[model samples]
Target chain A: MKNFYKIVAVVGLTMTLVPSLLFYFDVIEIGQMKLYMAVGTVLWFSGAIPWLGQKRTQN
Target chain B: MADKSSILKRLDSLYEFDREPVTRNKLQGIGNFLGMYAGEHVAGTEFVIGMLFVAHGVSVRDMFIGGLIGNILAIGSWAFLTAPIAVKVRLSLYWQLKKICGSMLVFIYNIVNALMFCFLAGAMVAVAATAVGIPFGIEMPALSDMLPNSVGWVVTVLGVGTVITAMAILGFDALARFAKVAAPWMFLIFVTAAIAVLPKLGVTPGAGNFWEVARESIWTGVAREGQSQFSFWHVVFFTWLANAAMHLGMSDLTILRYAKKWQYGFSSAVGMFLGHYVAWIASGILYAAANSDAPGVVAYEAIGIAGAICVVIAGWTTANPTLYRAGMALQVASGWSRWKVTLLAGAITTTAAMFPALVMKLLDFVALYGLVLIPMGAVILADFYFIPKLGLQSFYAEKKKIDFNLAAGATWFIMLALALFLNLYFKIELFFLPAPIWILSLGAYLLFSKMYQKNLKLNLT
Candidate 1:
C-alpha cells in the first residue's frame, strides 16, 4: 500500500512538473505541449491502477 | 464517558452492524481521492474559469505564474492541514463535529454547508444545460444572465440535474469510479478543443510570430466589452481560494479520513494543475477565439458545439462531487437517509440551475460560499489542536453531555460577523477575508472555551 502511494506521488508530481519544463525550455510546440500533458495525465491515472485494484481484491 | 457511549452507539446504528469499518489503506484511498479531485476539477468549471481569466484581463505571465503558485498553496493546504486530521480522526467531518461541538450546533452548520453545495452544483447543472440546449436551438444565457429565460432552459437543466443527482446518490464508490472514467477523457476534450481553435485565432505553429500572436491575440489580457476585468491578483487569489471551503475549510475531512498518510492530499495537484491550470489555459484560448466585434454570442459561441459541450461536461464533473457532499451535509442535518437527502438536494440543485444567475456570478458566489463555511473549519481546527495544548478538553460537548457547546457556537457566529464586517465596513475584497477569519476564529474559540470551562466546572475526565 505504501509503495503504491509513493508511485502515485512520483508519477503525479512528475506529470505535473514535466510539461511546465517542456513548455519553458521550448522543447515542444504548444500543440505538442498539450499532447504531452494529455499523455502525462494518462500516466498519472495509470499510477492509480494499483490503488483501484486494491479495492477489488479487498471486496 | 456516558455522553460518548450514547453517540458512538447511535453512529454504529446509522452505519448498520454488518458494514466494514473505515481503515487507512494507502492505495484504494489515494485512488478515490485522485479520481474525485481530478474529475471534479477538470470538468465544467474549467470553461467558466477560462472565460473569467480572459474577462479579468490576466496577462500571460500572471495567468501562468498566478495559477501555478495559487494551486500549489491549495494543494499544500489539503496535504498538510486537511489530510492529517482526516487520517487521525478516521471519521466524517459531520460525525466528528458532533463529538466536538454537539448535535445542535453541527446541525445548523451542516444545513448552511449543504445549501452552499447545492447552489454550486446548480451552477454546474446550468453549464451542462447550456450545451444540451445548443442543439435544441435553445437560447443560451449571457455572462451576466441571472433568471431562467425560457422553458427549454428549465427542462434542460432539470434533465441534466437528474443525471448528476443519480450519479451522486450511488455513494462514494460510484462517485470515485465516475470521476476516474471521466477525468482523462474530459481532459483530452479540453486540450483538443483548445488546439483545434488556436489557428483560427491567428496563432501559428513553430514560429517566433506564434508566441507573439499568443501573447497579443490569444492571451492578450484585455477584457471584451460588457465583461468585468480581472487582474493578476484576482486571478491568483480566486484560483487559490476557489476550493477554500473544501481544503482550507477542512470539508474534505470526510473524504481524506480513509487515507493511510497525509501525503495522499498531494494527489490534488493532478486536479489542480491539470484540470485547473492546463484546462483553464485551453478554455481561455478557446474563449479568446470566440470573441468578435459582431458578437451574436460570447467567446464560447465561436468555439461552436465542441467548446459548449466541454463547458457543460466541465461543469458536471465539478458539480457532481459538490452535490454529493451537499447531500451528505443534508443527511447529517436531517438524520434522513443519505440517498434520500441527496436526491432532494439534487432537486434543489436542478431548480437552481434553471436560473443562469448562479453560473454567471460564480466568481462572487464561490468567494461568498467559502467565507461562510471557513469559520466552521477554523473552529474545528482550534478545538482540535489548540484546546488540548491550552489544557482545555477537546470535544467538550461530548465530554460534558451538553446539547449545545457555546464556545464552539460563539466562535462560529463571531467569526462570521467579523468576516462580514471586514467585507462591508473595511471595504476589503471577499477573497482576502478567509485568512483573518481563520485566525480570529481560532483565538475566539480558545478564549471562549477557557471561560466556559471555568464557569461550568465541567468534569472533562
Candidate 2:
C-alpha cells in the first residue's frame, strides 16, 4: 500500500512537471503555458489525494 | 526479549520513560538533511524575497556578494550551534523544555511558537495560491491589500492549504518522502525557469557580453517604484537572518535531533545556496522583468501564468513542513492527537492566509517572529551547557516535580520584555535584537537557575 501510494505520487508529480519541462526545452510555446499548468494542477491534486488519504487512515 | 523486557520495566519505573526516548541511532544522515533543507528553503519565500529585493533597491554587486556572505552565516549557525545540541541531546525541543522549564511553561511557549509558525505557513499558502489562481482568472491579493480582497483568492488559498495541511498531518515519513520527490524537480524548475526567461529579459545567449547585460539589465539591483531600496547589507542580513529562528533560534532542534552527526548540520548549505542563492536570484530576475514589462500593474501580471504558478507551488512546499512542525509543537503542548492539532493548525493558518499584510510585510514578520522564539533556544542552551557547570542541576522541574519552574519562566519573560523595550523605546531594528536577547537570556537563565537551586537548598537546609 505504501509503495502504491508512492508510485501514484511520483506519476502525478511527473505528469505535472511535463509541461514545465517542455517549456524549458522550448518545445512548448509561451501561450500554451496555461495548458501545461492546468494539466499539472490536475495531476498534482490527483496524486496528493490518494497519498494524503491513505496517510490519514494509517495515522 | 529479556533485554527488551528489562528496558520496558525500567522505563515504567521512571516518569521520564513515559515520554519518548532520545535514541542516538534515530539521527539521520547528511543526505536527508540536505534534501529537506533544500526543498524547504527554495520553494515558498523565493517569490516574496525576489520581489522584496526589487523593492529594497539592492545593487547588483550588493545582491550577489551580500547573499553569499549571509547564506554562509546561516549555514554556519546551523552547523555549529543547532546541530551540536541536537546530536548531543537527541531529544525534541518540546521534550527537552518539558524537563528544563516544567510542563506549564513549555505549554505556554509551545502554543505561541505553534501560532507564529502557523501564521508564517499561512502566508506561504497565500503565496502559492497567487499562482494557482492565475489560470482560473482568479484574483490575487495585492501588495497593499490586507484582507482576502477577492473571493477567488480566498478559495484558492483554502484549496492549497488543505493539500499542504494533509501532507503535514501524515507525519515524518510522508514529509521526508514528499520533500525528496519534490525537491529535485523543484530545483530543476527554478533553474530552467531562470534560463528560459533570460533571453526575454534581453540577455544574449552564451555571449560573453551576456554577463554584463545580466548585471546591468536583468538583476540591476534597483528598486521598483514605491519600493524601499535594499543594499548589499540588507540582502546579506536578510538572507543570513531569514531562517534565524530555525537555526540560531534552535527551532530545528526538533528536526536535527534525528541527525546522525553534527556535520549533517553543514548540509544546510544545499538549501542555502540552491534555494537562497540560485532560486532567489532567478525569481528576482523574473520579477524584475515582470515589473518592467507591466509598469504600473502588479508584478505577477508581467511574469504571466507560469511564474505565478511557480511561486504558488514554492510557497506550498515550504509551508507544508513548517505548519507540520507547528502542529507538532501544539500537539506536545495540549496533549491532543497530532493529526487533530495539525488539522486545527491548518485551519488557523488558512484563515491567517486571508490577510495579506503578513505576506506583504514578510521580511518584518520573519524578523519579529525569530526574535520572539529565539530566547527559548538561548534558555535551552544555557540550561543544558552552563547550569551543570555552575553546580545547578539540569531539568530542575523534573527533579523537583514542579508544575512551573519560575527560573525558566522568569528568564523567558525578562528577555521578551527587554527585546520589546528595545524595539519600542529605542526604535531598534528587529534584526539586531536576537543577539542581545540571546546573550541576556543565557546569562539570566544561568543566574536564575543557580539562585533558585540555592534557595531551594536553603529551605531544605
Candidate 3:
C-alpha cells in the first residue's frame, strides 16, 4: 500500500514536470499545461500527505 | 524586579531542556537538516528578491557568478561560524545569550527581534495580498508605490493578514506539514515558470542566440526608473549577507543545536543553490518577461493559476512561522499567553502589511534587520572564544548574577551608532555595512569586556 502511494506520488510529480517542459517546447498548449499542473498538484497532495508526517518531520 | 525575575523563570520552564545542553540521544541526522534547510529557503522572499535583482540591473554574467560566490560564503559561514559553536555548546541562541548578556539585555533583544520578525511577516503578507487581489482586478502596486493604493488593496491585505494570523495563532504543525509537501513542488514551479516564459522574452530554446536574447531583453544591465544600479559586488554581498541574522547573527544556533555533527551545516548548500540561486534566476526571468513588480501578476502570467496560488501559499506558509516566532519572542518579554501575544503580533504585522513599501524595499529591509541583530552575535563569539583567552571570565553575567552586562550592551549600541554614522555621513550602502561593522563589533566587545571585567573584579575585592 505504501509502494502504491509512492508510485502515485512519483507519477503526480512527473505529470507536474513533464507538461511544463512540453509547454516550453511547444509540444502542448499552455491551457493543457495549466490543467495538468493543477491536477498534478492535487495528486501530489493526495499521495504525499499520508506519508509526510508519519515518516519524519520536514520542518 | 521580582515580577521580571518570575517571568524569566517562567520563560525558562516553557521549553524542554532549553536552559542546558541538548542531550546526545535527541540529535538528528543530516537528512533532517537537509530537508529543513531546503524547505525553508525557497519561500515568499524568493519571489520579491529575484525580481528585485533584475529591477536593480544585474547583468547575466554578474548574476550567476556573483550569486555562486555569495552562496558559497553563506554556506561557509553556517559551517564554520554557527554550526561549530552550536555543536560545542548544544544550547539555543537565546539561552546561550542569556548566560553572556544577562536577562535584562536578552529581554531588550527579544523585543527588537520580535519587531523585526513582525515586519518580515508583514512583507510576506503583502506578497500574498498581491495574489488575492488578482481575481478582483485590483490594481497591483507599482514599484514606486509606498502606500496602500486602493480600497481593494487595503481590503485584500486585511483579509489575507487575518487568515495568516489566525493560522499562526491556531498552530503551526499543520501548516508546517503543508509547507513540506509544497516545497519540492513549489521549487519545480519556479523552474517550469521560467522555462514557460522564455519564449515571451524572445529566447528560442534550440537557437544559439539564447544568451544574446537573455542579455538584451532579460538582464539588460539597465535599472528601471527610480531604482539604484547594481553590479557583481552588489549581488555577491547581498546574497552572501542576505541571511546574516541566521548565520552570522547566530540565530540558527537554536536549530543547529540538534544536529548530530557540525558537518551537517553543509546541508545549507541545498537551500542556497536551489532556492537562492536557481529560484532567484527563475523569478528574475519571470519578472523580466512580465515587466511587473507584482509577484502574483508575473507568476500568474508565467504559469497561470498555479503560479498565483503558489505565490499565496508561499507567502502564507512562510509568514505563519515568522509570526509564530514573533509571538514566541514577545511571550518571553510580555509574560502573556501564546495566543494573546500572537494576536498582538498579528495586529502589528497586519498594520505594516497595509503599506506596499515593505515588500518593495525588501532588500534594504532584509539587510537592515540582519545588521541590527549581528552585533549580539559578535558578542557571543567574543565571549565564547576570546573572553577566556583574554583572561576574562566567559559568561561573566551569569557568574556574577548581573541582570545587564554593561560590556555586551555597550558593544551592541556602539556598533549600531557606528553603522548609522557610516551610512548617514559616509553614504555607504546598507548592504556593505554588516561585514565591517561585525569586525569592529568583535574588537569592541573584546576591549570593553577587558575593561568591564577588571572594574567588576576591583569592585568585588
Candidate 4:
C-alpha cells in the first residue's frame, strides 16, 4: 500500500504535468487533454489521502 | 461523518500561539519570512494585477521604474514599521489590538478585517477555480463577470475552496511548507512562460531588438476600451499601498510575531522584487501573447496544462494563508473555537467566490481594505510608544477595565471620515488615501487620548 501510494504520487504528478507540456508543444490535442487532466487531478488528490486522513505522518 | 469528524478534530487541534508573546526559542529565522513573503506576493493575484497594469495602459518605463520604487517603499513599511512592533510585542494583531483598543472596539475591527480578508481570498478561490474548470469544460468568467456564469463555476469554486480551507485549517507549519514547494515552481513557470511566448509576440532574440518589441507591442501605453489610463505615480502608489494593511496597518503583526528579529521583515524584498517586479513583467508579456485577462487561459497558452496548474496552486498558496488569518480574526473576536470560526470564514469566502466582481475590482478592493484598516494600526502604534512618553498610561483599556477605548474609537472614525472626504471630494485615489490617514490618525489618537484621559482623570496609574 505504501509503494502503491508512492507510485500514485509520482504518476499523478507526471500525469498532471506531462499532458500540459505535450499540449503546449502540440504533441497532444484538446480532444482528450482535459479528460486526462481531470483524471490526473483526482489521482493527485487520492495520493494525498494519507495526508488528509491523519496527522501522524512524518513532517 | 467519520471523515468529517476527523477533519474537525484536525482543525480543532490547530492552535495559533495566541494571547502571549511567542517565546524566543520558537522564533523563526529570516528564511521563513523570505519563503513566506516570496510565496505570498508572487501569487495568484499577480496574474490579475499584471493583466490589469497592461489593460490600464502603463508604459514600459513607468512599470519598470515605478514598480521598483513602490515595492521598495512597501518593504520599508514592513521592515521598519510592522515588524519592529510585531517582534517587540510578540503578539498576534488581535491580542495586541485588544490590549490597546479594548475587546469591544477590536471586535468591530476584527469583523471588518475578517470580511475583507475573506473577500480577498475568495477572489483567489475563483482564480483557482478557473483552472479547475478548464478541464471540466466549465465556462471561464470574463473580466467583467459579476455573477456565477454557470453551475460549473459554482462547483469549481466549491472544489477549490475546499482544498484551500482544509489546508488553512491544518495551521501554520503546513501552510509554510506548502508555500515552500509552490513558490519555486510558480516563479520558474512565470519566467518560463514569459520567455517562451516572447517569440510569438515578434521579439527576435538574435537581433537583440527585444526592447523595441516590448515598447511597441507588449507594454504599450494605451488603455483598453472602457479602461482608465494609469500613470507612473498610479503604478507606484498601487504597488506601495496594495499591502498597506499588512505593513502600515499592522496586520502583519500576526506574521511578523513569528520572526526572530524585526529585521527579518526586510525579507519582503524577496517577494516584492521577484514576484511584483519580475513576475508581474513576465505575466504582462504572457497577457500580450494570449490577449486574455483570464490567468488560467493565458498560462495554458504559454505552457499548456502546467500553466493552468500553476494558476491553481498559486491561488491556493495565497488564499490558504488569507483565509487562515481571517478565521483566526473571527475566532479571536467572537471567542469561538478556532476550527468552528475557520469553518464559518471558509464558508463565507466560498460563497463570495461565486461572484467575479471581487476579483475584477481587486485593485480597488485591495486599496479599500488597506485604507479601512490603517487607522486602527495607527492607534495601536500611538498607544504602544507615544502615550507612555506623554505621561499617560499605555494599554489604558487593560488598566482601566474599559470595554471600549473612546480615544481609539474616535481616532478610527475621524480618520475614516477624513479619508472619505479626501477620496470623494479631492478625487484622491485609494492608493493615495493611506498616507494621510496614517499620519493624521497617529497625531489624532495621541491628542484624543490625552484629552479623554485628563477629563476622566483616568491617568490615576
Candidate 5:
C-alpha cells in the first residue's frame, strides 16, 4: 500500500514537472501545461498526504 | 472524544522543549534538520523578496556572485556561531536568555521579540491575502501603499489572517504534515513558473542568448521608478542580513537545540542554496515576466491558478509558524496559555496586516528586526565564550539571582542607540550595520559586565 502511494506521488510529481519542460521546448501548449499541473497538484496531494502522514522509519 | 481541557493540553504540548533543554532521546537527525531548513526557508516572503531584488536594480552578475558569497557567510554563521552553542547548552534561546539577561530583561525582550514576530507574520498574511483577493477582483495595493487601500483588501487580509491563526492554535503536527507535502510542490511551482515564463521573457533554451536577455530585460540594473538603487554589495549584504536574526541573532538556538550534533547546522545549506538562491532567482525571473511586485499578480501571470494557490499556501505555511513562535514569546511574558496568547497574537498580526507598508517595506523591516534582537545574541556569545576567558562570571544574573543583569540590558540599549546614530548621522543602511554593530555589542557587553561584576564583588565583601 505504501509503495502504491509512493508510486502515485512519483507519477504526480513527474506530471507536474514534465509539462513545464515540454512547454519550454514548445511541445505542449500553455493551456495543456496548466491543465497537467493542476491535475498533478491534486494527485500529489492525495498521495502525499497519506504517505507523509505516516510515521517515518528514521528521524 | 476527549474533552476541551484535554484537547488544549495536548495542543499545548505539541511543541515541546520550550522552557527546558531537549532530552537526549528526543534529539533529531541531520535529515530532519535538512528537511526543516529546506521547507521553512522557501516561504511566502521569497516571492516578495525575490521580486524586490529586481525592482531595486540588481544586475544578474552582481546578484549571482554576491548572493553566493552572502549565503556562504550565512551558512557559516549558523554552523559556527549558532549550532555549537545550541548543541553544548541544549537550551532554547528564551531559556538561555533568561539565565544570562535575567527574568526581568527576558520579559522585556520577549515583548519586543513577540511583536517583531507578529509584524513579520502579518507581512506573510498580507502576501497570502494578495493571492486570495485575485479571483474576487480586489485591487492589489501599490508598492507605495502604506494604509489599507480598500474594503476588499481589509476583508481579504482579515480572512487570511483568521485561517492562519486558527491553524496555528490547533497545533504544530498538522501544520508540519501540511508543510512536508507543500514544501516540495511549492518549490517545484517556483521552478515551473520561472521556466514557463522564460520564453515570454525572450529566453530560449538553446538560443545562447539567455544571459543577454537576462541582463537586458531581467536584472537590468536600473531601478524601477521610486525604488532605491542596489549594487553588488547591497545584494550581498541583503542576502546575508535577511536571516541574520536566526543565525546572527541566535534565535535558531531554539530550533537547532534539537539536533544531535553541531554539524547538523550545516544542513541550513539546503535551505540557503535552494530556497534563498534558486527560488529567489526563479521568482525574479517571474517578476521580470510579470513586471509587477505584487506576489499574487506576478504568480498568477506566470502560471495561472496554480501560482495563486502556491502564493496562498506558501504564505500560510510561513505565517503559521511565525504566529506560533510569537505566541510562545508572548506566553513567556504574559503567563497565558499558548492558545490564548496565540489568539492575542493573531489579533495583533491581523491588525498589522491591514497596513500594506509592512509587506511593501519588508526588506527594511527585516533588517530592523535583526538589528533590534542581535545585541542579546552578542551578549550570549560573549558570556558563553569571552566572559569566562576574562575571569568574569558567566550567566551572572542566574548566578546572583539578579532580577535584571544591568550589563546585558545596557549592551542592548547602547547597541540600539549606536544603530540609530549610524543610520541617521552616517546614513549607513540597516543591511550594512549588523556586522559592525555586532562587534561593538560584544565589546560593550564585556566592558559593562566587568564593571557590573566588580560592583557586585565589593557589595558582597
Candidate 6:
C-alpha cells in the first residue's frame, strides 16, 4: 500500500511536470499541452484519495 | 428518489465548522496557502488585465515598476493588516462582523458583500466563455461592449457557470483542493504560452533583443484608438488595489483564518509575484503577439488548443473560490443552508456572466467593488482596535445582546455616501477613492461610536 502511494504520487507528479517541461524546453509546442497538463493535474490530486481515505485525523 | 431535502441533508453532513474557531489540529500547512493564493491570483483575469494595460498605453518601465511596487503593498497588507487579525480572531469576516455590528447591520453588510463577490466571480465566468466559444466561432465581446454579444455567448456562460457552481457547492475544502492541484499547471501554462508567442513579435530565440521587443511591441506607450492612457501611478494603484478588497477590506479573514500562523500571510507573495506580476507580463506579451481580443484565440494562436483551455481553467480556479465566499456570506446572512444559498448565489453569478460587459468593464467593476467594500473593512478595523482602547467595549453587540449596533451601521452608510458624493460630484476616479474613503471610514466610525455609546449610555466595559 505504501509503495502504491509512492508510485501513484510519482507518476501523477511526473504527468504534471512533463508537459510543462516539454513546453518550457521548446520540445513541444503549446497545442494540446494545456489539455495534457490539465489531465495530469487531475490525476495528480485524484491519486491522493487512497492515501487520504485511510489517513487518521490530525487530533 | 433523491430530492432537494436529501440533497441538502447530504450537503449539510459535510458540516464545515463555520461559526467556531478552527482548532489547532485542523490547521493547514503552507502548501494550502501557497497553492490557493497562486491559483486564485494567477488566474483568467490576468489575460484581460494584461491586454488592458496594452490598450491603455502603459509603458514597459512604468508597468513593470508600478506593478512590482503595487504587488508588494498587497502582500504587506495581507501579511500585516489581514493575517494577524484573522489568526487572532479565527473567524470568518461575516461571523466576526455579526459580533461587532450585531445581526441587523451585519445582514446589510453581507448582502452587499455577497453581490460584489458574485459579480466579481461572474466576470471570471464570462472570461471562461470567451475561451469556450472559440471553437464555435462565437464573436468575442469587444473592450467597450456592455451587453451579451450573442446567444452563443449566453450558452457558453451557462455551461461554464454550472460546472464552477457545482464545484463550489461542494464546500471550502473542495475549493481549496481544486486550487492546490490546478495552480501549478495553470501557472506554468501562463509562462510557457508567453514564451511561445515571442517569436511572432519578432523576438526569436537568437534575436537576444527581448528588452527592445518588450518595449516597442509589448507595453507600447500608445493607447488603443479610443482608450485613455495609463501612467505609472495608475499601474501601481490598479495593481495594488486590484485585490484591495480581499486584503484591505479584510475578506481574507475567511481564507487566512485557516492558517497555522500569522506569518503565513507572507505566503500571499507567491500569488502576487507569480500571478499578478509574471502572469500579467506574460499575458501582455501574448496580447501584443496576437491581434485577437479573445484570450482564448490569442492563446490559441500562440500555444494551441491547450493554451486556450488554460484560459478556461484559469477563470475556473479564480471564480470557484470567489463564488464559494459569496455563498458562505449569503448563507450566514439569510440563515439558509449553505448549499442552497450557494445555488442561488451561483444563479446570480451565472446571470451576470451572460453579459460580456461584466468582463469588458472589469477594471471599473473591480475598482467599484473594492471601493464599496473598503469602508466596512475600515469599520471592522476600528472595531477590532478602537473599541477596546477607548474604554468602550469590544464585540459590544455580542456583549450587550443587541440586535442592531447603530454606530457600525451608521458608519457604513455615511462613509459610502461620502464616497458616492466624491465620485459623482467631485469627479474623483475610482483609483483615487480608496485612500480618502479609508480615512473617512475611520473618522466616521470613531465619531459615531462615541456619540452612539454616550447618548445611549450603552453597557460600558
Q: What TM-score does each of the candidates earn?
A: 0.79, 0.81, 0.97, 0.83, 0.94, 0.86
Residue-level lDDT of model 5, residues B1-461, one tens digit each, is 34434433433353343666788998987998999899988999899888888888999987799999989998999999999999999888877887898877876787798899999999999999999999898988988899999999999999999988988998666776787788999999999999999999888879988899889988999988888998899888878878988998998998899899999889999999999899999988999998566799899888777888889999888888789878876775555777998999999999999999998888889889988998998999999999999999998988998868999999999999999999999999988998788889999999999999999899999
Query: How accurate locally is residue B124 in candidate 6, as Cα lDDT from 0 to 100?
Result: 90
Segments in model 5 whose C-alpha atoms lie over 4 Å from true places = A55-59, B1-24
DockQ of each: 0.06, 0.17, 0.57, 0.09, 0.56, 0.22
Please identify model 6 stretches exceeding 4 Å from their true place: A1-59, B1-18, B22-28, B166-176, B258-260, B332-340, B458-461
Residues B144-194, model 3: lDDT tens digits: 999998888889999999999898878677877788888988888899889
- Runs of candidate 2 exceeding 4 Å displacement: A1-59, B1-21, B158-176, B209-222, B291-309, B328-343
Q: Tens-digit lDDT track for model 4 on B1-461? A: 23433433332233333666788987887886887788778889998888878878899988999999999999999999998899999888777877788766876786788899899999999888877887787887777778888888888899888877876786745665556555655776687667667667887446787788778877799987777788999889889988888898998898899898889999999989998899989888898888556788888877667678889888887888788778876765455777787888899999999898787778888889989999988987888889999999888888877768999999999899999999889998887888889989999999999998897685564
Off by over 4 Å in 1: A1-59, B1-32, B162-176, B291-309, B331-340, B458-461
Error of model 4, residue B307, in angstroms: 0.4
Candidate 4 accuracy as lDDT: 0.79
For B423-449, candidate 2 gives per-residue lDDT tens digits of 899987776677678789899989888
The worst-scoring run of ten residues by lDDT in candidate 6 chain B lies at B7-16
Candidate 2 docking DockQ: 0.17
Q: Each model's RMSD to truth, in Å?
A: 7.0, 6.5, 1.6, 6.2, 4.1, 4.9
Q: List model 1 lDDT by residue over B1-461, tens digit each.
A: 12444544444354342233356443255786787677667767777777667766778877888888889988998998888887777667766677788877776776788899899888888877777766687767776567887787788888889988887786556555545554565676666656655566665555447567667976677776677666777777878888888887887887787777889999989889887799889777777777421111332353343345445556676787788768766665455778888899999999898888787777788888888888778777887778999999898888988767898888888888888888889888887777678778889989999999887895444
What is the Å distance of residue B92 in model 1 from its true position? 2.7
Clash count, candidate 2: 12
Better of 1 and 5 by DockQ: 5
Off by over 4 Å in 4: A1-59, B1-16, B150-152, B162-176, B332-340, B458-461
lDDT of every predicted structure (CA atoms) = 0.72, 0.71, 0.89, 0.79, 0.87, 0.78
For each of the candidates, what fraction of the native contacts does it recover? 0.00, 0.13, 0.53, 0.00, 0.53, 0.13
Interface CA RMSD, all predictions: 7.9, 5.1, 2.2, 6.2, 2.3, 4.7
